[model samples]
Target: MTKSQIGLRERKKAATREALSWAALRLAVERGLENVRVEDIAAAAGVSPRTYNNYFSSKAEAIVSRHCDRIRLVGEALRERPPAEPLWEALTRATLAPFDGAAEQPDPRWTAAVRLLLREPALQAELARAGADAEAGLAAAVAARTGADPGGLHPRLVAAGVLAALRAASDVWLRADPPVPLQPLLAEALRQLAAGLPEPSSS
Candidate 1:
């Protein structure tokens, strides 16, 4: 196949994947996760059930795939940071940059849907699968930046810790009563992580 053809094919696949994920999230949020099925999501996305199955194992996986995509984008951003930048500085900037994009503006409905997904056991399992993949990608990026072996302990530990901080921030943001902006919360989380989680002392 020609280069243009390959590019077109990849773009088409990405569009399909995005459509399926959006449909899954909307349906699951509108009708409850237990009420959503593969066929329903495929129909909503204008794809067949077989095509949906090709992209995701279940409706829960489809719904959570969007978060997984964000995680992948963070890893890519981290990889592109200046090589001479301090590890934590690069990580903080890279991790929050994606959320800062104009296309990533806050959506209360989407945030609520994510909160609902977090409360679902089946969806949480799918999220764990996605998290594992993100962690592996992050470890590689850490290794590239710090010259540590990707398979060794240092890179893996740093990647895991950074992800944990981000996760904690996300949970706090989602649960906030008045709805806090995610980017600033995530920034503070990374900052605290970089600062070694120091305690406040009376001065």
Candidate 2:
């Protein structure tokens, strides 16, 4: 196949994967995870059950993949950033790129739905498993940008640090007594990380 054909094929596959992931999350939210089957998710995505099987082994995996898709997109975004941009700046933009046009404040109903879905034990397990893969994807992107070895410590640390900020930001967002905009929290988290996480002076 020509290079353009190959690119088109990959884009189609990505769209399908995203469709399945989003469908799984929506169904799991609308109906509890236990009530939603693989067939249901596939149907929601307009794909066959067998096609869903090609992308995800379980409903939990399909749901978790929605987040993974964002992480993977961040990697792609980083690659496209201008070479002169500082690493942390590029990373911040890359991370937030997937969220552009997102409401500064997240909708409470959507947050509630996500919280309910995340409480599932099976989904928790899937998140734990997926975290490593997410980190590796980011690490590879960092390596590619800096010409570091893909397996080296620097890229690995940078990836781990970014993920840590994301998780911290997420936890704070979810647990905030008075709801706050996630974008600011996310930006702050990355800024702190890039600044070496300085100690706060006591009042």
Candidate 3:
């Protein structure tokens, strides 16, 4: 196949995946995650149930994939950062870049879906699976920058640490009573990670 044909195929797949994710999240929000069926999501996305199954294993996976997709973008952003930039700085910027302008104008429906996911055990499990996939991609990106083997411990550890920090920061942000901005929480999390996670002294 031609390069253009490959590109078109990739774009079509991305569109289909995105449609499924949006439909899943919207339906989950409207009818609760437990009540949203795979067939329902496929119908909402204008795809057959088999097509939906090709993209996701379950309704929870489809809904959680929206956030997982952004995590993958973070890996891409890290790869695109200037090579001369410090790894931590590049990571910090890349990690938070996707969330820029989103905190200020939060989408109510998205927020609702997130809250639902946080509360649902099945969705959390799907999110964990998604995170593992994101971590592997991020490890490859980090390896590319550091000239380490993608499967080596150094790249994998760094990727895992960065993702863990982001997860912790997200939990804190989500639990905040007034709903703190995610970017700052994420930035601080990365900063602390970069700073060697110094222990705080008792006052």
How well does each candidate superpose onto the true structure, as a TM-score? Answer: 0.88, 0.84, 0.81
Look at candidate 3 and tell me the lDDT of residue 144.
Answer: 99
- lDDT tens string, model 1, 1-203? 99999999999999999999989988887888888888899999999999998998777788878777887777899999988889899999888876774233446676677687679998889878888888999999999888888899998988898889879988887777667788888889888888988997779
Clashing residue pairs, backbone N/CA/C < 3 A, model 2: none
Instruction: Between candidates 1 and 3, name the one with more favorable lDDT.
Output: 3
- Looking at model 2, residue 71 earns an lDDT score of 65
The 10-residue segment of model 2 with minimum total lDDT is 99-108
lDDT of each prediction vs. the true structure? 0.85, 0.87, 0.86
Q: Best to worst by TM-score, what's the order?
A: 1, 2, 3
Model 2, runs deviating above 4 Å: 1-6, 101-103, 147-150, 201-203
lDDT of 3 by residue, 1-203 (tens): 99999999999999999899989988888788888889999999999999999998878788878678888788899999999999999999899987775575355556655776668898888778879988999999999999999889999998999899889987777666656788888899999989999887688
The residue pairs found clashing in candidate 1 are none
lDDT of 2 by residue, 163-182 (tens): 88888888787766567877
Off by over 4 Å in 3: 1-5, 101-113, 149-152, 199-203
